[model samples]
Target: MSRVLAFPAGRRAKWLVLVAWLIILGAAAPFAGKLFGAVENDRLGYLPKSAESTAVLEQQEAFPQGRVNPAIIVYQRDGGLTAADRARAADDQRWMAGKYMPKTPPPPPTVSKDGKALIYQIALVAPPDKQEGNYVLDAVDAMRKHIGDPGGGLEVKVSGPAGRDSDQFLIFRDMQYQLVLIPVIVVAILLLVIYRSAVLFLVPLFTVAVANQLGSAFVYGLIKNTDLVINSMSTGVLSILIYGAGTDYALLLISRYREELARHEDRHEAMAEALRRSSGAVLASGGTVALGLLCLFAADLNATRALAPIGVLAVGSAMLAMLTLLPALLVVFGRWLFWPRAPHVGDSKRAHGFWTRMGETVQARPRRVWALTSLGLAVGVLGLLAFNVPQQTQFTTTPDSERGQTLISAHFPAGNGNPATIVANAAQADQVKTAATGSGVVGAVAEVGRAAGKVQYAATLNAEPVTAAERSAVHRLREDVHAVNGAEAKVGGPAAIQLDQRDTNVRDSWITIPLVLVVIFIVLLLLLRAVTLSVLLIATVALSFGAALGVSTLVFEYGFGWSGQDSQLPQLAFVFLVALGVDYNIFLMSRVREESRRHGTREGVIKGLVTTGGVITSAGVVLAATFAVLVALPVVSFAEQGFVIGLGVLIDTFIVRSLLVPALVHDIGDRVWWPSGLARGTRQRAERGRELAPDKSR
Candidate 1:
C-alpha cells in the first residue's frame, strides 16, 4: 500500500501519473458536457415505483390521447373582463388548439363566480417518442409566445401541469451550468483563503476539477446505458459532492505533506511519508461516505434510489484524483508551491498556536465543556418539531405557473387546474365513475380516454393539491372506486404523486438512516481500531445532524418565512450529515490514537487536536461553502439542503470536533480506546515516563 501510494510521487512516476490523468480528462471532457442532456426530469422519475400514481402513469401511455399535459392560461381583470378581453382569450384558445391539439379542441373558457377572471384549459398531449422535459419546454414556450403581452389591465399567465413542468425544466436546465460554476467559484475562494498562497490552491482545485469531469462522464454513461434513473436534482448534488469531497481530501494530503517536508529533505520522500500517513483516513472517509450513499438504493423513490450509484461514483472519482493526481502534482512542484510560507528541513514546528490554546482550554474543563456543548446541541434539536412537508411547489422565486395557480385558487376551485386521474376496467367504467363522484371528496368525474379494455377518468378534487385534505380525498376516491366490482381501479395525478412522495420519504428515512448509521459505525470501528471511540464519534455526528436540522427548521419557518420543507430534506440531510460529519472525527481520532502510542492518552488528545485542527476545519469550511452554493439556486429544496448541510458541517467543524469530542475523550482518558491495548494505560504510562526521561544524553 505504501509503495502504491508513493508511486505517484516517484521521480519518473509523477510525470506518468500526470500524463495518465491528462488522457483521462481528455476522454471525460466531452461526455461530461452531455451529462445534463441525459437527466430524466419526467414526473415519474420523482414518484415512488409502487405508488398508484406511478401505475396510472404507466397505464396512461396505452390510451388514445396518451398522457395529457394540461396547460391553463389564466386571464384576470380586477374590474371584470370586457368583451374585448373575452374575444382575445377566445382567439388565443383557437390558436393554441389549432397548433397543439389539431384534432380535438380544448374546452371553452370558464368565468369565475366574481366575474374577475377567466381560464382556458389546453390539453397538450405528450408524444410517446419525445422526451417529456423538452416537449413541455417547447410547448409552453410557444404558448407563452403566442399570448405575448395582454395589452389591457388583464393578467395573462400559463399554469397547470404543462406550465409548472416547463418552469421546473427551465430551472434544471439553467442549473446545469450554475451548479458547476458556483461550486467551483466557492471552492476556489475558500481554498485561496485557507492556503493564503497564490499558487498553492491551484493544484487541488485543478485536481478536483478533473474529478468533477470524470464523475460527470461516469454518471452520464450509467444513466445512458444502464437502468439507473437520474434527475436534475441528482446531477446538481453530484457536482457539489465531487468538488467538496475531492478538495477536502486534497487539503488533508497537502497539509500532511507540508508537515513532512519540514522533516525530510527529499520532496519525494516527504510526499511518500505524507501519503503513507494520511491515505488511510482519506480512503476510510471516502469509503464511509460511499457506503452511506449506497444505502439510498433501499429507497423506493426513483430519485432517491438513483442517488446511490451517482454518489458512489462521485466519491470514487474524488478519492482517486486526490490520492493520485494531487500527490503527483505536489511532488512535481516540490516545496516552492507553498512559496512565501514554505516549510524547510530543520525548521522548528510551531508548538503553540490558536489550536494549541484551544486544546488547553478543552483540557482544563473537559466535563464542563462537553456538558455545555451537549446541552446547546440538544436545544437545537427542538426545532425538528416544526418540520412540515411543503404543500406548494418548492421554489425560491415565483414563476409564471405559481402565479397562475394563485389566480386560479382565488377565482376557481383550489384544485381547479390540476386534477386527479383514475384508471379502471372499461367493463366497470360506469360503476367506477359513479363511485368516484359519490365519494364526496371528488367534485366531478369525466371520461378521458379508453384503450385495451381500460378506461381513464379525470377527477376534479374539491381540495387543493399537496394538502392533508387532498391526500384524504384521493385516498377516499381510491377506496370508493376499488369497492366497485371488477373495476381494478387506481387513483393518481399531481395530488396523488405528492402524497406518494411523502409516504415514500418516510419509509426511506426509516430504512436508509439505520443502514447508513451501521455502515458508518463499521467504518469508524475499522479506521479507529476502537469500539468505544467509534460509538462516541457516531453519537456526536448524529447529534450534530439533529441540531442542524432543528436549526434549519427554525430558520426556514421564522427567518425565510417558508411554511414547510421538501419531503426528501430530512432523509438526504441525515445521510450526508452522519457520513460527512464523522469525517472530521475520524481525522482527529486516528491522529490521536497514533500520538497516544507515544504519549499518554490525555496528552495525545491535546497533540492530536493541535496537529489536525486547522486542516480538518479548513476542509469543513470548504465542504460547507460548496454546499452553501446551492442556496443561490432557484429551487427551494436545493436551498434548504444547502443551508442545513452547510450549517451541520460548520457545527461539526467548530463545536463537535474542536470542543465536544476532544473534551469527552480527555475526560475519559485511555478508557475511550476500549478493547485496544491503549485502553490498558500501561503502554501510555511507559511512553509518558520515556518522554519525561528524554534528553538524558545531553
Candidate 2:
C-alpha cells in the first residue's frame, strides 16, 4: 500500500506524473471555461418532476403564452400620484407593449386604494430556443434601462419573478469570479505564512488550481450531457471545496515529507516514506468527506441532490492532485523548495513546541480540561432556539426588486405581483376555481390560459409570498383544488415552490444527516481499526458541529440581524462540519496510533499532539478561511453558510482537536484504544515503561 501510494514520487515517475497532469489540464481547459454556461438556474431545473409545481410548469409550456416570465413595474409616489405621474406610467407601459408585446397589449395599470402607487404587469414571452432564466434576465435589463430615472419623486422599479431573477443573476455572475479569485488569494497568503518559504507554497497552489480546472471540466460534462442538476450555488461550493480540501491534503503530506527529509538523504526516498506514513490518513479524510457528500443523493430537493455529484467530483479532483501531482512536484523540486528553513538529513526533530506545553497542561488535570471545553460547547447549543427560515429577500443589499415589492405590499395586496398558480382539467376548471376561492386563503382567482385539455388559473394569495402564512395558504389551496373531483388540480407558482422547497429540505435533513453520520462512522472504524476510538472521535466532531451551529444561530439572529436562515443551511452545515471536523482528528489520531506501537497510548497521545498541532491548525485555518470567502457574497444564504462553517472549523481546530480530544485520551489512558495490543500491555509496554522511567541524572 505504501509503495503504491508513493509510486507518483518515484525517481522516474515524477516527471511522467507531471507530464500526465499537464496533458490532462490542456485537454480540460476548454471544457472548464464553459462550466458556467451549462449551469441551470430556472425553477424547473430545481424542482423534481414529481412536484406539483413542476407539473404546473411543464403544462404551462403547452399554453399559447407558453411559460411567460412576468415583470411587474411598480410606479409609486409618497404623496398621491398626480395626473402627470399617471400619464408617465401609461406612456412607459405603451412603450413596453410596442417593444416586447406588440400583438398582446398588457393589462391597464391597477391603482392603489390610497392613489399613491400603480403596478403594471407585463408577461415576457419566452422564446423556444433561449433559456428561460437568461431570457428573463435580458428582457428585464432592457426594461429597466428603458424606464430609467422616473422623475418628480415618482419611483419606477421592476419586481415580481423577472426582477428577482435578474438580481439573482447579477449575484451569481459575480460569484463565479469572486469564489475562485478570493479563495485562491486567501489560500496562497496562508500557505506563504505557514511555510515561510518563498517557493514552497506555489507547488500546492498550482496543483490544486489544476485540480479545480479538471473538476470543472468533468462537472460541465455531467451537466451538459447527463440529467445532473447543476446550479450557481453548487458550482460556487465546488470551487471552495477544491481549493480548501486539496490544500489541506497538501499540508499534511508536505509536513510528513519535511519530517522524512530530516531523516533520509535522498529526496525521493524521503517523499516515498512520507507517502507511506501519511497517505492512509489523507485517503481516509478524503473518503470520509466524499461519502458524506454522497449522502445528499438521498435528498429530495433537486438543488441539494445536485451537490452529491458536485462534491464527489470536487473532492476526487483535489485528492487525486494532492496524492499524485503534489507529491511528484515536491520530489522534483527537492529540499531547495524549503529555502531558508530547508530540512537536511540528520537534523534534530523539533517536537517540543507551544503544543507540547498545552499537552503538559492537559496532562496535569485531563478531566478538568475536557470537562471545561465540553461545557462551553454545550452552552453554545442553547442558541438553536433562535433558528428560523429567513424571507426570500436574503440579500445583504436591497435590490430594486425588493424595494419594488415593498412598495407593492404597502399599497396593493402583498401577493398581488406573485400569485399561486393552479392547473386543472379544462372540464372542471370552474369547480377548481370556486373551490380555491372558497378555500378562504385566496384573495382573487383569474383564468390564465387553456390548452391540451388543461386550464390554468392564477390565484392571488391573502399573504405575502414565501412567508409561513403564504405556505399555509398554498397548502389549503392545494387541498381545496384537489377536492374538486377529476380536476387533477395542482397548486403551484412561486409560493408553492417555496413550500415544496421547505418540506423537501426537511425530509432531506432527516435522511442525509443520519446517512452522513453512519457513513463517516464506518470510515472512521476502518481507518482507526479501533471501534472505541472511532466512536469517541465521531462524538467529539458531532459536539463540535452542535456548538458551531448554536453559536452561528445566535450570531445570525443577533449580530447580523438576519431574520432567519435558508432551509438548506442546516443540512449543508451539518454534513460539512461533521465530515471536515473529523479530518483534524484523523491526522492527529493516526499519528498517535503510530507512536503508540513504540511509546504506549498515553505518551503517544502527547507526541501526536505536539507533532501535528501546527500543521493541523494551519490546515484548519486554511479550510476555514477558504469557506469564509463565501461571506463576501451579497447573498445572505451564502454568507451564513460561510460564517457558520468557518466558525465550526475554528472551534473544531482550536478546541476539539487541539485540547478536548487529546485531554480526553490522556485521561482515558490506553483504554481509549481498547482491544488494541497497546491497551493490553503487551511486550511493547515493557519497552515503553523503560523509556518513560524517571532519569536519575535529571
Candidate 3:
C-alpha cells in the first residue's frame, strides 16, 4: 500500500501534509473573501455569448440609448385622472427626466386609455467600468426619495428594468451575506448530532471550510485574469457544493479510518490503510459529480454553464482534501479525535449497531426488499406525468415590478415599458408600420426613432411582455413585418429575448443530457472496471433521476404553486440529480467491488451494505440540509433547484443506493460483476455469514 501512496506515508509525513495545507489555507484566505465581488446579476448576460438574445443585447449597444437601465413610473388615479392629476403626472415626468437625464432628456409620459394610468420611463446610464449594479440602485433610491409616496386616492410605484434589477440585486446581495452564515450553522448542528464527539464533529467542518477557501480563491483568481463570469447564484451554489460534497468526502474517509483503527496496532498504519481503502470511493464519487458538472460547459445558458468551472474546482478540491489534508489531520490528532468512544482493536463488529441488523434483514430476502423499494420509487416516478417545466421566472408575490406589470396589462398595452421594435430600411418605414399594426397582437405601432438609414418602429403588445402570448405576438409581428416587400425588419425586445432564451435552453438540454450520461458512464467504467456493473449503475441512477424529477414536479406545482420553472431547470435538474445521485452509488459500489474480491459475492454484498450505509446516509442528510438552505434565498428558481436536487440526493441515498442496488447485486450473485474474476466461479461465491455468527473469528 505504501508503494502507491501520495502522502500519509508515516507519522512525520502526516505533519508535513498538515503544514502544507495550513499554509495553503492561510494564503487563500484573502482571495476567498473576494468571491462575492465577482458575482454578476445581469439576467440578459445569463444567455450564451452567441445566443440570439445575447446578439440582441449587443446590437442594442449600437443604438442611441445603448444599454441604459430604465425606471418606469406607474401612476394610477381612481375615477379616472382629474385635470389636476394629469398635469401633475406630466410635471413629474419632466422633473425626473431633467433631474436624472439632463444630457438626454427622456420622452413624455404615455397615459393609458380611460385616462387613469400613466407610465413615465427614465433611463440611467451606468458608469463605464462598473459591474456591481449599485449605480442603478443608487439612482432608484434617489428617485424614491425625490418623489415621495402620494396619499390621495391615487397610487404610484417605481418599476421596470431599473426598479426590478435594483430589487433583485439587493435580494441577491443580502442572500450572499446569509449564504455564508446559514449553511455553516446548518452543517454544524447536523454534524454535531451525527458524530456526537465534539472534536470529531469539528474535524469535517474545519476541513471543508479550508477546502472552500482554497476553491473560492482559485475561482476568484480565474475571474480576475480571464473572461470568466460568476453571479450570486454561483457563489451560493459553490458554498453548498463545497460544504456538502467536501463534508461528504470527509465523513467517508473518517468512517473508514475508525474501522481501520481496530485492525492495525499502529495509528499511522491505520491512517495509511484507511486512506488507501476509502480514497478510491471518494475519488470515484467526486469524479462522477465533477464529470457531470463539466457537462454544464456545453449549455447555451451562461448561468447554467458557469456552474461548471466552479463546480469542478470545488469537487476536485474536495477529493484532494479527503485524500491528503483530512487523512493527515486525523493522524496528527490521533485516536483522541474520536475521544470517549475511540476505536480499539476488535471493536468494529460490536460498534456496527443498527446497520448490522439492517444488513441481515436486507440479505435475508433480497428480492422482497429490493422489489418493495423499487415499487415505492415507481410511485414517485408516476408524478412525472403531472410535471410541466416552466420556461419563465416565477415571482411569488406582487412586488413593485409585478404590480406595475399588472397595471400596464390592465389599463394600456401590456408591453408599455418594453415594446417590440422593428428595425427596417427607412424606405420601408410605412410598410413596416402597416404590417406591425395589422399583426393583430400589436395594439399600437409608431416610428419611434431612426438610426443609420434604418427606421425603428415600436409596437406595444396587448399582452404582458414576458408572457407566452407576448412572445407569440412578437414572433408573428416579426414575421409579418419582414414579409412586407423590401422590408428587412429585425425584431428585438424583452419578449423576443425571452422567446430566444426559452428556445436556446430547450436545445441545450437535449444536447447536454446525452453528453452527461456518456461522461458518467465512462467514469463508472474506469472505477468499476466492469462494463456490466457500470451500465447497471448508470441505469439505476437514471431511474432514480426520473423518480426524483417526478416527485419534485408535484411538490413545486401543488405545494408551492409555482406556475413555470426557469428555462434552464430541466437540464440543471438532470445534471445535478443524475450526477449527485450517482455519488452514493459510487460510494456503495466501489466498496462492494473491493469487498467482493476479498470475501465471496454474497458475503461481500452484506459486508458492503453494512460498512458504507450509515456514513453515506449521514452524508446524504448533511448534503440535503445544505441544499435546502437555498429555499431561504430570495429567488424562487434557487428554491426550486435546491428542492429537486436535495430530494434526488435523498432518494439516491435511502432508496436506490441503500436498498435497490445492494439487493439486486445479491439476487444476481457473481453475475453482478460480469467479465471480472468473480464471474468465473459463481458456485464458490457465497461464504459463511460473518455477522450472523456468535464470535468474531477469522
Candidate 4:
C-alpha cells in the first residue's frame, strides 16, 4: 500500500496516526486526575483586581453605597396618573417586595415629566451580593406579573441592574435562534456552492459538529483550573472557527483529491498525493492563525486571556478533524465525493495573462499608483487622533430597539448603566470619612472594618454621572483619599478600574505594538527572503492598521457616540492588523517572488500582481464579510470590532498589497532584494532554467 493509505511513513499520512492518538487520549481524558481536579477547584468568581483599584475607590465614595439600581415603571395617563395607575404601580411594587424583596417602602418613587415614565429607587433587603437564586430575576418576574393590565392609558414595567441583567439573559436566549440559524444557513449555501453534492457537503459539516463537541468539552475542563469568565461572544467566535476553518480545510483536501483523480490513479495514491501537495499550506495557514490567537495570552485582562486557549483549542480541534476524520472519510467515500462533478486529475494552473497585464501596467508607472494609494490611506488614518473612547456600558441590546433603549435612556444617567463599587481599606476611620466627603463625591456610605489592626472603610460613591471628567474625579478622589492624615488608603470601583485599564492599555500598547510588528517582520523576512521587502511590507501593514483604526474611530466616536477605547480594542486591532495584513502580504509576495524569479524584477512584479490579485482579493472579501457580520449585533463594541477588522482586511487587500507594495517593488528594482543572497541565487537558477528549456517549449 502507498504511504498515504498506510497512515504512517508519509508526513501527511502520519497526521492520521497522530490525530488518532490525540482523539484516544482526549476520549480517555475525563478519567484522568487532572481533569477531575480542575473540575473540583472552587476559584470561579475571582476577577483579578483591576490595576485601577485606587481610582474605583474615588468613584465609589461619590455614589450611594456604590449601588445605583433604579427600577423603572412605564405608564401612560390621560392627564395625571389616574387613581387607578398609581394604585396599580404601587401594588406591583408591593407584590415584588413581598415575593422577592423584603416588605419595606423604598426611597420615594420618582415619576417622569411626561407622566409616561416612573422610577422607584428600591432597596434590596439582602445586599446585592447575598441575593438568592437570581433574586433579581425572581423580583422582576414578580413585578411584571403584578403590574395589572392597563385598562385605558396605563402600563407599568420594571428595569434596573437586576432587571436589565435578567433582560440580557432573556435576550441571549432568544439570540439562540440566530446563532443556530445563521451558521446552518451559511454553511448550507457555501457547501452547495463548493461541492454541489449533498453527501460531500454533509461530511465536512458533520466533522465540524464533532469538533465543536470535543472543543467545548476540553474548554470546560480547562476552565476548571483557571479563573475565567466566558462572555456571551464566546459562542459566536467558536462557531466561526468551526465553520470557517473546517470548510477551508475540507476545500483544500477535496480540491487536491479531485486534481489527483485526473491522472486516473487509484484512490490510495490519489489521497496520499493530495495530502502531500496541500498539507503544508493548510498547516502553515492554520499554525499562523493559531499563533495569532495565542498572542492574546499577552493581555492582562481576564476576558482576553480566557479567549486565548479557547481560540487555540477550537482551531486545533478543527485541524485534528481535518487531518484524521476527513482523510478517513475520503478513504471510505473515494471518488464519490465529487458525485456529479466527478474527480478529474489536471494541473491546477492559474490563468497567466490576467496578473501579468496588471503587473505590466503597475510596473510602467509605480509612482502615480503609490502616491494615490498613500494619499487615500493617509486620509483614513487621520481620523484616529480625533476619536474618543466612551466608557458607556450599554453593551447589550434587544431586538425591540426603540422601546428598550428609550426606557433605559430615560431612567438612568448613561454612566449609571453600569456602576461598579469601590472599597478602600483606610488606616483611620475619620480620615476615610473626610476623604469620602470630597467635592467630586455626589454621596457616600461606609462599612467600618477591623482587619490586621487597621480599619477598612467600604466607602460608597454616587457615580451616577460617570464621564471622562468623572474618571478624573476618581483620580482626584484617590489622591485626596490617600492624602488623609495618618491613614493608608486603597481604592477600587468600576470607573476606577476603567481608568486603570486605560493606563495599562497605554503601557501595553507601547510594549506589544512593537513586539507584534517584530513578529510580523520576522515572518515576512523569512517568507520573502528580503530585508527591504519585509521592511516595506511591515510599513504597508502599519499604514493599513492606522487606516483601519481611523475608520473605526470615526464610526465609533462620531457616528455612534460609543467610547472608542473598548477594553479589548487596541490589542484586538494589533492582532488583526498584523495577522490579516501579513496574510495579504504573504499572498502577494509569494507570487511576486515566484514571478520575479521566473520573469525578472519588472515582468515578475506585473505577473505576480496579475496572477495573485483576484485570489487575494476574493480571500479578503470573504474574510472581511465574515467579520462584518458582527455589526448586526446590538453592542457598539462588537460593531466597532467588526467594522474595524473588516475595513482592515479590505484596505490591506486593495490599497496595501494590491497597489502600494506592487509599485514599490516596481520602483525599487534589484535593490528590493539587495542584501538577500538567496533571492539572487533563485534569480540565477531561473535564468539557467530558461536557458535549458527548448525555445519552442518556452
Highest TM-score among the candidates is held by which one? Answer: 1
Instruction: List runs of model 1 lying over 4 Å from the truth.
Output: 682-698
Off by over 4 Å in 3: 1-6, 77-95, 113-116, 132-134, 148-154, 348-353, 682-698
RMSD of 3: 3.3
Model 4, TM vs. native:
0.78
Candidate 2 displacement at residue 423 in angstroms:
1.2
Off by over 4 Å in 2: 390-393, 682-698
Number of colliding residue pairs in model 2:
0
lDDT of 3 at 323: 79
TM-score of 1: 0.96
The lDDT for every candidate, in the order shown, is 0.88, 0.88, 0.78, 0.61
- lDDT tens string, model 1, 469-501? 888888898889989988899998878887888
User: Residue 88 in model 2: shift from native, Å?
Assistant: 3.2
- Give the Cα RMSD of candidate 2: 2.9
Q: Worst 10-residue stretch by lDDT in candidate 2?
A: 689-698
How well is each residue in 428-450 modelled by candidate 3, as lDDT tens digits? 88988888888899888866566
- TM-scores, each model vs. reference: 0.96, 0.95, 0.92, 0.78
lDDT of model number 3: 0.78
User: Model 2, 623: alpha-carbon shift in Å?
Assistant: 0.5
* TM-score computed on alpha carbons, candidate 3: 0.92
| Tens digits of lDDT, candidate 2, 1-698 | 77789898799999999899999999999999998887888888898767888888888889888776678899999989999999989999999888778878578899999999999888887777887777887888898899899787989999987788788887888678888989999999999999999999999999999999999999999898888778898999999999999999999999999988888899998899889888988888888899999999999888889899999999999999999999999998888899989999889886667898988888788899999999999999878877786455467888998899889999999988788888899999889989999999999999988999999898889998656788888999999999999999998888888788777787789999999999999998777777788889999999998889889988878887777788888899999999899878988998888777666777888888988999999999999999999898888888989999999999999999999999998898878877666677623765866688752210
Cand. 2 Cα-lDDT: 0.88
